[model samples]
Each structure stands twice: as C-alpha cells, then as structure tokens.
Target: MAAEQRKLLEQLMGADQLIGTGAQGRNAQLSITDNKVCRSYLVGTCPHDLFTNTKQDLGPCSKVHSEGLKTEYETASSAEKAKWGFDFDYMRDMQKYIDDCDRRIDTAQRRLEKTPDEIRQTNNLLKQIADLNSTINTGLLEVSVLGETGSVAMAMNEMHKVRTAKHQKETAERDLKNLQDTSGPSGHQKLQVCDVCGAYLSRLDNDRRLADHFFGKMHMGYSDMRKTWKKLSVELKGRAPPVRHHEEEDPYSAGPRSGRNQRYGGSGGGSGGYRRRGRW
Candidate 1:
C-alpha cells in the first residue's frame, strides 16, 4: 500500500510524462524530419519555431538547444503527450474510486440501521410475556369448572382454585427468570417502557400478562424479535451472543425447561436447558 501511494505521488510530479508513439513504428515521430528541416531556412532557435512551427499533426517537437537538439526535441514532445494521456486516465480512475467508496458507505449505513436497539429488544420481550400470560389464563379456565350449588361442584371448585394458584406461581417464576436473564451480567440486556399498560414488568411472565390486559395485538408483534436479532447479528456482524453459561449446569441458563425442574415448580437444570412451563 505504501509503495502504491509513492507511485501515485511520482505520477503527480512533472518527471512523469505521457508520450505518443506511432502505431506502426512504436517510435516517437517528429514533425520536422531531416527532409522538412533541410527545406527550411537555418536559423538560431526561436520560441515560435520551438513551441509551434516545428510540428505537424500534433507531432513531438523539441525546443532545447543542445548537441542532440533534434533528438531531444522529438523525445521531449513524445514525453509531454504521454504525460497528458496519463493525466486523463488518472482523472477517470479517481472518479471511479470515489464512486466505489460512496457505495460502501451506503451499505454500511443500512446495516447499522437494521441493528437491534434497546427499545426494540424491550418491546420484543413484552410480546413474549403476553403470549405466556394468555397461555396461563387459558390453561386455568380449561382445567376449571363452574356449576350450580352442589357437593361435587364445590369439590371441583376447590381443585380448580388449587390449579389456578399453581399455574400463576409457575408462570410468575418463568417471567422472573427471563427478567433476570435479560438484566443480569449480559451487557446487552435491554428493555423498553410498556406502551400498552403504562406499567413495566421485566419478567417474561409478568410482561405477557400485562400486555394481555393492555395491548394484546401489539404484544405478540415482537415474538420474533429475539430470533431476528440473532439472525441479523450473525449474518452481518459475524458474531453471536456471549456463551455465558455451561449447558450441563446453571439451572438459571436458558434452554428447554423440563423434567425434575417442572415437577418441583421451580427453575433448575434439566435434560435440555429451557425449563418446561407448568402450573406451579
């Protein structure tokens, strides 16, 4: 790169010349050949002859007074023409270089715009929470019964109450864990103010429930945000989220929530990392 810069600088100097050579001979041709000069009057070098009269058809002509004056004149003319051609080529190259740079800058700016921001991440989390809330609410009703006054109905009602309480606790815990995960040691943690309910819940479970009560439609809109962010960062930046936890341990780590963790109605290690959602 440094050497290329130097070469370009050299071209800028007057030492570099653009010369014209014949297509047939590849040799510099002079307008004032021996035949032409012999026919002309012998005279001391004059500016008019040196600069203009000596050449025809834009030929290389020399003005230098020296023993090799004739040869020098031809060589200098060719060099000058070559330099002009080189300059024209250089200007064209410079324009192309600038155009390429502009394209690169535009591409970079688009990528930056698509990059995830704190507000987007937060909105995404809230949507996930709303989904979870809906699931819990539906599950509660599915397992519950309403009936006229009766012994069996009362027993069923008691069971339904127990089930509902259990469900709420489990969902709340999942929401809490999600909140901690996003807000913990991970520097990328981000959450946005809740637009629907005007109240915020960092936990997934809580956020979902709140969204359900406030802005149900808008909440799920961001369900794909996490996946989207992961995809964009991987494809564009060539980086991934930090692997902060080991797969075998750390009950708090994200994966498929399942097994003993589910039975206990708590967040803990399982076959897969994510805990299975259940009524606590």
Candidate 2:
C-alpha cells in the first residue's frame, strides 16, 4: 500500500522525468564517443593491447584516456542519496495543496453553472430599464418642444405675447431717447413711422396702419417662418438660440418688397411682423 501510494505521488510529481536514466546515460556515452573520435584523428594509436592482469608492460588504453569515462560515479551516488532521502513533509504538503485545489475547482465549477442564468436575468432587466428611460426622455422632449397636450397653442401664444411686450417697451424707450436728443418740425409726431420702412406717419390711417402692421400679417408670417427655421437651425446647431431681454426691430430696411412678400405670404395670415425676428 505504501509503495502504491508512493507510486501515485511520483506520478503526480511528473514520474516520467524523475524516474528516468535513459537520456542522461546516452548523453554521457555521446561525450565519450566524441572524445575518442577526436583523439584517433589527432594521434596515431599503438597496435598492442593495453589490458594486463599481473606482470606485463602495458601501453595506455588510448580509447579510455581520450574519450573520458562513459559512466559517472558521483552522479550515481547523488541519485542513490536523493532516492533514499525522500521527504514526507513535502509529500503531505502536496497532498494538502491538491485537496485545497480540488475544493476551489469544485466551487468554481458551481459558480460557472449558475452564471449563465444570472447573466441572462441581469441583461433582461437592464434592457427593460433602458427602453423605459428612452420612452420617458422622448415624451419629455416632445412636451418641451411642441408644448403639452391641452396647452400647446396656448403656450406658443403666451410666449409670443411676452416677447412682443418686451419688444414694444424697448422700441418705446429708443423713440423717447431720439425725441429727447433733437428737435423736428412734425412736433411730437416725428416718432410715428412704419417700424419696418422707417416712413413717417402723417395721419390716423397711418397710425392704424402701423398698429395693424405691428399686430398683423408680418407678425404671424414671421412667427410661422421662425417656427420652421428655428427648428431646423436649432437641430443643426445643437443648442438653444441666444436670449436677449429686449430686441429692437430691424432699422435697416429688410430687403425689398419681393423679399418681404415671399416669406410673409404663405398659408396662415401672420399677425406678428418682421419685428419678431430674434438673434441667432
């Protein structure tokens, strides 16, 4: 039983290498053969036989001297000692280590068996959350852009109203300052003009004209154009347009009659005018 156990232990420790005498002895033979070949070529050999038992003049065994020894005594001695002095502690440690390794291997196998199911569950949950988050984000962006369900039109109208009020306040202040700066023959009426063309207003018709112009076709037309263009520009630019608290109407005449009519005369009649155009 002890021998069998020792055989098993040696097998575990690579018995093929530890138990062998084949390659080592063969290599020693090759060294001796090489030395002998070299000596035979370099020096002429004696014809006489070199072996003597008792009393005779003996010549050198050139083959033995030149080729050196085929067998190694010291090496054989060490092999014998190593074979005798086998360690029980090392064997016991190796057995313990192998036992621990087997336990770890079993645990790893169990973990691997459960991993695929757990991974599938985790992936499913992650996919569900990802889809839910995407839907929610889409809804929120739609509400923010096109406004809410019940109040979409209202929200747009309210925003336009606020923007218009702010613009009127600014224009009024500029007109007040211009009036303060210089004197003119039209008295206080020098301020009344087509805000678009800067043409002077001479009558109530012109005043009505300007008011109609202010809250009329140009306003609605420009607002519609802005809705389309602003959407396009914002998508391209990847950011919101800049905000100014108040903006003035374009002082420089906005192109020609052709330019104004082309943009302003689409489908919906515009109530708000070119004054509605904001900064980029």
Candidate 3:
C-alpha cells in the first residue's frame, strides 16, 4: 500500500513546483502525484465541485481547485493540450460516470413505475403499524384481565398474542425505515430521480431545496460535463468539421461574378455608353 501511494501521476510543472528536491513549499518534494492540486479541475471541471449535500454527493475533493493552475492549463496551446491529452482522459473518466448515472436513471425509472407515489405506500405502512399497535394493546389488556380472573393459561396465551404482535410491529417498523430512506430524508415525500445526475430528489420539496438541487454542485457538475462533451468530443477527437465554427461564417459576402452579360452594343438613342462585358 505504501509503495502504491508512492507512485505519482504525470504532472505539469507549476510555478510553485520550482521549489523541487526537498524544498519547503513544493508539497514536501514528494512524488509528482503527491501534489495537493486537484487534477480534475486542472484538466477541466472537477466532479467534486458538484452534487454537494445531495444523494450523489462525491464528498469534498481531496485536492485543491487552484484557479491559477486552471488558467495556465486553459491558456496552453492546442499542441500542448494534445500532448497532455487531459481533455480526452477527463472525457473517458466522465463517460464512465455519465454511463453509471444513466443506469441509475433507468433503474430509478423502473422503481418509479413500481412505486408510483411512495407517499401512498408510507401511509399504508403507517396504517398497518397503527393496526398492529392496536392489536398489541388489546392483547395486553386481555392478558391483564385474564390474569386478574385467575385464568393463568388464558393469560399466558394472550401474552403470546401480544408477543406475536410485537414481533410483527418490529418488522413493520424496519420496513417503514427502509421505505423512508428511499423516499426522502424527511420521510413523507415521493422520490424522483434527477435527470442530470440520477440522484433521488423529493417531489414535495420546497423552493429552497429545489433551488439547491438545481444549483448544487453535483447536478451542475454533470451539466458541465454535457456542455463540455458537445465541444470536446468533436474538437479533441477530430471528427466532422465543427458545425459551431462553420455556422459563424459571414452570411452576406459577395458571391462569385461570372459571365452573364450579352455582347450586344449600346442602343442608338442616347440610351447607352459602353457595351456590357461578361466579366463586368
């Protein structure tokens, strides 16, 4: 494990990396992979910045999202970017993430089909719990009354009923807990998968939480990935001519001038000066 940790990824030389070889400010002069910088952000967008506090939250990024390093990466020439191939590397990594999220979205859709509205299931569970509790209470009362009447066997039998009801109640409680976990943290809402990241969001959530979902990092990160893919997939991979660039060409330029005029001379009645030329 220590040996694995010692391995470093290929890294671009940063301004701060000048302090190499047992230097103070150079990440303890350790392996290149030991840098505190976040490679994902350095190459492009970092997934860590997205889906914060949501179900798909990836937790905080382990490395720093240094703006200076990001700027340097962006300003580098196309040749340099091609040499590094960070764009395509990030693309593959993000392709896996997107593919996984797509699967989750599909699964969530099937789950939604089965569940429809989970709140209704929750209500049913609650009703079952209430019925079970009522049975337990009634059994306990019967047990106590039978004991008072000196019916020892009947009281023991009634106690058995109470025990069975209690066991059923426990099972129902665990089921309810699992349902709530899937439904929402608040425990009363219907769940829907986010189209962007496939994390479950509450259908009954308020504006505040909804806004958070829209603006949150994980959702936004996937959104960024899509936008980047639209461009980089063609640019980095060298596919068809970029339609975006093609669409930006000036639309109103003068077309080619060719042979169109006749060779006839001017009219005799003050109607003409020079004869029309095909090249004019």
Candidate 4:
C-alpha cells in the first residue's frame, strides 16, 4: 500500500509539472497556459488571470499540463476512494460543510466577545440614570425644604439627563440581549449540521433560504449520490444491484446537458464539484 501511494504521488508530481523546489521545498510549478484549468480552479479559489484583477507576473497554464494534472487527480482520487470507502465528491462536500461551520463559529465568537462590552456599557448607562434620578430627587427635596424655586431648574436638568441615559441604557440592553441570545450555544442562529448532505445550516435561516437549501441541486445531488453509493455497496457483496422503478426518477440527478449550473440549484452547463453560487 505504501509503495502504491508513493508511485501515485510520483506520477502526480511528474504529471502535474510539480518539479521545482520552492520556499516549501519541492513544489509544483505554476501552469502557464489557461489559469482556469489549474488545480486551484477545481477548488474555486484560483487567483490567476483576471480573477484577481491584478497584473502579476504569474505565468499562464498550459492546456497539456492542465489535462495531465486532471488525469493524475482522477487516478489518485479513485485509488484513495477505494481505500477509504468514500469518493472525492463526498469529501469535498464534507469539507465545504466544515469550512462553513468554521466561518459561522468565528462570527459567533466575535459577536459573543462584543456582548460583554455591550452589557458593561448598558450597566454604566443604567448607573448614570440612577444617579441622575437621585440628584433630581435631592434637588426637589431642597426646593421643598427651602420653599424656593431656585433648585427647580437644576432638578429639571437632572430629569432630562435621566431620560437620555434611560433611552441609551434601553438600547444597549436590547442589543446585549440580542447578542447573547444569538451567540449562545442554544441560540436561534446557532450552527447546525445537516445529516443528509453533511452541510452547515444556520438556525436563523429564513423559510426561503431553508427551502432553497433543502431543494438545492448540490444538496439533493449529494443525497442521491449517497443513496446510490449505499446501494452499490450492497450489490458489490455478490448480489445484483437492485432495479429502480421508472416512475422513481431522482429530481436531483443531472443529465449530460445539466452542466455545472445544476450543482448550484440552477439549470446550466458545467461538470462536478459543489458549484454553489457563493461557494464550491
């Protein structure tokens, strides 16, 4: 197994034009033909060409090099899947879910940090209001005790400060509550993992987004693929694959013309990988 993996790595390194030593030691050379065909392109993070909107000295990607790299990837992926009992597609889907979860958790943590500051600010404002109320009461008592109108103006000023501070305190408290509610583990916007497709879902997602996600092409396609994989696994045990009824058409199944657009819950042309609108 080790020898096989080593051979596969060597073939990949040679086929992918990864021959040069870089800062990270031996690394793949950048392609110099079409940037769209690079390995990073498959992950939707390619920064070459117009994608970065910069005129860097990055070279082009050779068509031949790109094809060879793709072939090597497919070959290695097939072997890896056979060894791991899962395909590259499934791995990519799970990775996307993980990335999404990380992003959400980061956001939630940031929000959670801000909540303490908000609570402190609100408490300070409340204290100010309370002090102002006491001042106003003291001023009013002075006016009544001395039977003079001189302290009435001072009491009115304190009342105004109390009103303003009360308003600010209310606003801050509301914000703090919202942050705590949403940033807490049991928050409405808490992170959720979809069991079917292994995707990260937001608890605060609206009806439309939830519907789109549930009915989205990528989610549905992955679900179908999982079912198919299970069926195939069962059949591989010296039994024929079960036949499906003609009426039981998978709505998420893509045809030849479906293209990559199908992966985004849209109808268009392109190949595999999670082809979502914002992320792959």
Candidate 5:
C-alpha cells in the first residue's frame, strides 16, 4: 500500500524530486559539454566555484559539463575566457520574437478573413452614394428645364439625400481603411520582437515602452546568466587542464636559518665564541 501511494504521488508530481542537483554543479557540468564558458569567470568576476568558500546561488547551464573540467577552466587566460563568452541571451530573445511573430501572424490571419466583408460593405455604400447623386442630378435638370419654383423644392430634397449618402459612404471608406491598416499586408502597426526577452514590441509612434523594457532587470539578468553559461562551456572544452606550478627552493633555506652570531654565542669572550661572564 505504501509503495502504491508513493507511485501515485510520483505520478501526480511528475518527478521523484522537486528540485534537481543545485544550479552551480549543473551549470559547471554544462559549461564543459557545451563548449561555452561562463561569462562571469571570463571577466575575472566569477566568485563561485569548487575552490570558492561561499554560497552558491547561480543556476544550471543549458548544456552539460563535469567536476574535472573546473581545473581546465581555471588555467585558461583572460583573453581566452572572454572569447568563450557569447551573447546567449540575444539568441533566446530572438527565439521569443519569432514566437511572437507567429502569434501575430495567426491573429492577423483571423482578422483578415473579415476584410472581405468590410470591403463589400464599403462597395455597397459607394453604390448607394452614386444612385443618390444620380437622383439629385436628375432632379436639378428637371427643375432647370421646367423653370418651375415648385420643382426646386423637389430638387432640394434629392440634394439632401445625396449629401446623407455621401457622408455614409465616407464613413464606410474610413472604417475599411482602418481595418486594412490593422490586419492588411501593409499595416501601419507593424510588430517588432525584443532582442533581450522575446516580448512583443509595438511599432506605434507614441509607444515609449521599448526604452524601459531594455533596461529591465529581468532582461539584463537573463542575458548575463546566459553569457556566463556560454563562456563556461566553451572554456571547459577548448582549454587544457591548468598546469600546477611548483616553485623550486633550496632545502637549507626552506625555514628560518640560524644566524652566525647565535651559533657562536657563549658564556665568555673567546676566539671561538663569546660567553656570559657570570657562568663558570
């Protein structure tokens, strides 16, 4: 029964452990396999490692590496480390932008289906306006040919109808233009994806949110983390293990040497040494 319950719990949770091995270890491993080095280390800024006596909070790398790789990383030159650090965040952001574009395209396609109906409505309005115009022209001609003051009143009524139809037609055309601009191939509101975080960027002239978004902490942090992982991975794979430098020293001078004066000191003054006068 206990086994069954455990199995059920595992199924519900989808995994045996909620959290895997810590971020630092995972990232360290990934740094080796991915051939991307950690960015923090490249700039002489990485504070966490096996040798470091501090808390580890950094997350795992998307790639893979192992513990033995750390020594190779430490031996690499600063210039080499820098070369490994690439803009990984930018790639992630670009992927996000691509996703946004797909969604926008989907939405635009749905709205595009309604465009035909809008165009049809506009055409109907134009036809109505044309008919009204014809009626007004015909009425004016009748009044002019007859020279009848009573017919002038009839022409004025037709003129009023023409004006109303023209106004309605104009309104329809305006609506049609708006719809096309929003969902058409040549839309005024073009979309741009963020290079840092994959968020949809507005192309509106008045939108100033892009400036603020680029400076957001989330974007910068993700970028930095990605860069670190890339650098770590590359450095681990490309560089050889760090060579341990052993300094050569004279065995006699390994520790403090006995001074000539101390070795010669004695109880009284002599050719061999000086000695204390009180001691026999």
Candidate 6:
C-alpha cells in the first residue's frame, strides 16, 4: 500500500522525471506516451484497480495513476484535452466496463430469483417444521395428562416421544432460518450483488468470506470507480465536445502496448517472476 502511495506521489510531482532523469538537463514533458501517466485516471478510475488478491485479481495497472497528470488534463484548455484524447478514451473504456458489469448483475439477479422447484422445496421444509412442532406439542400434552393421572410409565413413554420430536423440530427450524437468508426480506437465500463491486453474494455466506470480499482489491477498486465515474462523466460532457466511436485506437500508445499489468496478480506474477523480468 505504501509503495503504491509513493509511486503515485512521484508521478504526481513529476519527481521521477524531473529529479534523476531529464533530457538535456530539463524536466521531461508530460504526454500521452508516458505510461507513467494513466489515461484512465485522467477522467475516471483505472481497470487495474478492480481486483486484487481475488479470483479475478487484476495486478497493478500497466499505466501509472498520477494526480499530476489528472490535474494537467483537467486544467488544459478544451482543445488541448481534445487533442490529447485521454478523457475520451477513458470514458469509452469505462462505459464498456460499467455496461458489462451491469449486464452481469442483471443476469445474476435473475438467476437468484426463486424458481418453482426451489419454492416448492422451501414450502415442503416449512411444512415439516410445522408437523414436527405439532407432534412435539401433542406428545407433551399427553405426557402432562398421564402424569396428572399418576400413570408414571405412560407419562415417561410420552416424554420420550416429545424429546424425539423436539430434536427433529430443532433441526427443521435451523434449516428454515438458513433458507430465510437476510439477503432480502424474501424467505429464501436470495443472492445479492455487492454494491461496491457488482459481484454476486449471499447473506448465507460465512462472515469470513464476506469480510474477504469487502476488503479484497477488486471490490475496493470498484468502490473507487463508483465514486469517480458518474461525476467525471458529467464533468467531461459539460466541459468538452463528445468523442465519436470511429477512432478505436488508443491515442496514448504509439503502437500496441504490452499487457504487462495482467501478468501480475495473486499468484505473484505467474512464477515467471515479473520482478526477475525487471518490470518492477
């Protein structure tokens, strides 16, 4: 976390480019080609942040996230930003990402809705609970009546029946409670999407699993994006002319950029040692 902060600070201040390295003893100019300046960060969130240490963990963004570049992009004249194309590319990428997540969420929600088979199962389970309770009550009533009549053997036999029924009732109640998961007011374990990450989750999930999801990188990354995208989109629309879809090429890369960022994730860089490749 600290390393990320330091890297961000350096990029923001242009310190890495200014202090130890410069062309002809002058500070290097900031441009789209500088991978150190994340184009996505200029307008909104970067994709690399969406997952970390998760099944879908995305490693450190291939491009750097720098407040300095964002500020530069922000303060530039409308024409300047238009020429840079950073804002447009970011929005384009982000919209597609957001749309895809929305689709997934919709699909998950539909899947989570109770089907006829599941509903019938739940109803059957409820009936079992009710029948077990009724048996337990009836046995208890009989035991009480026999005990009052001084029939000790009969009362004892009735008490045993009640105990067995009581045990069955307890198990049935537990299952019922589990089925009535708190994911929704509905009486079933309806899956819910984690608002922070758009991933499907269930209230029936263990506390530890839920904690891991909330604290995990992908979820937090989406949190960061959620906070930024809508505001950024509004700001861009008001401030600059809209970009068309014809230009699919990323203006930042002179040619195709390597998918270096995808190589590093929870596996610690694919055992090929991204660090050994001197990427870090």
lDDT of 6: 0.59
**Candidate 2, TM-score vs. the true structure?**
0.22
The lDDT for every candidate, in the order shown, is 0.33, 0.35, 0.58, 0.43, 0.41, 0.59
Clashing pairs in 3: 50-217, 50-218, 51-217, 51-218
TM-scores for every candidate against the unseen true structure:
0.19, 0.22, 0.42, 0.27, 0.34, 0.46
Q: For each candidate, how many residue pairs have backbone atoms clashing (under 3 Å)?
A: 19, 10, 4, 12, 28, 3
Residue-by-residue lDDT tens digits, candidate 3, 1-280: 5422222211244334433432565553332122355556767766655555566767555555455567777898976655544554355445556667777777765665535467788888899999999999999999989999999999999899899999999998998888876654334357666766666777677989888877877777777776665555555433221111232221111221111001011211111111221110
**What residue runs in model 2 are displaced by over 4 Å at the alpha carbon?**
1-80, 92-100, 112-114, 148-150, 153-280
Better of 3 and 4 by lDDT: 3
Model 3 stretches astray by more than 4 angstroms: 1-39, 52-54, 59-71, 115-190, 202-209, 237-280
Stretches > 4 Å off in candidate 4? 1-84, 87-96, 108-120, 141-280
The prediction achieving the highest lDDT against the true structure is: 6
- lDDT score, candidate 4: 0.43
Ten-residue region with minimum lDDT total, candidate 6: 271-280
How high is the lDDT of residue 181 in model 1?
55
For 1-280, candidate 4 gives per-residue lDDT tens digits of: 8645543554567434433322232334432222223433332222222112222213332322244444444566544434422222222233343344345545544543435655676577566656655655665565465445566666566556656655665675666566556654445466555544445677778889898878865556445544443443333333221223343212123333123123322221112222232222
Per-residue lDDT of 265 in model 6: 18
Ranked candidates, highest TM-score first: 6, 3, 5, 4, 2, 1
Error of 5 at 157 (Å): 3.7
Best by TM-score: 6
Each candidate: RMSD to true structure? 29.4, 46.4, 21.7, 16.2, 25.8, 12.5
**Ranking by lDDT, best first?**
6, 3, 4, 5, 2, 1
Q: Look at candidate 5 and tell me the lDDT of residue 183.
A: 57
Residue-pair clashes, model 5: 28
lDDT of 4 at 160: 66
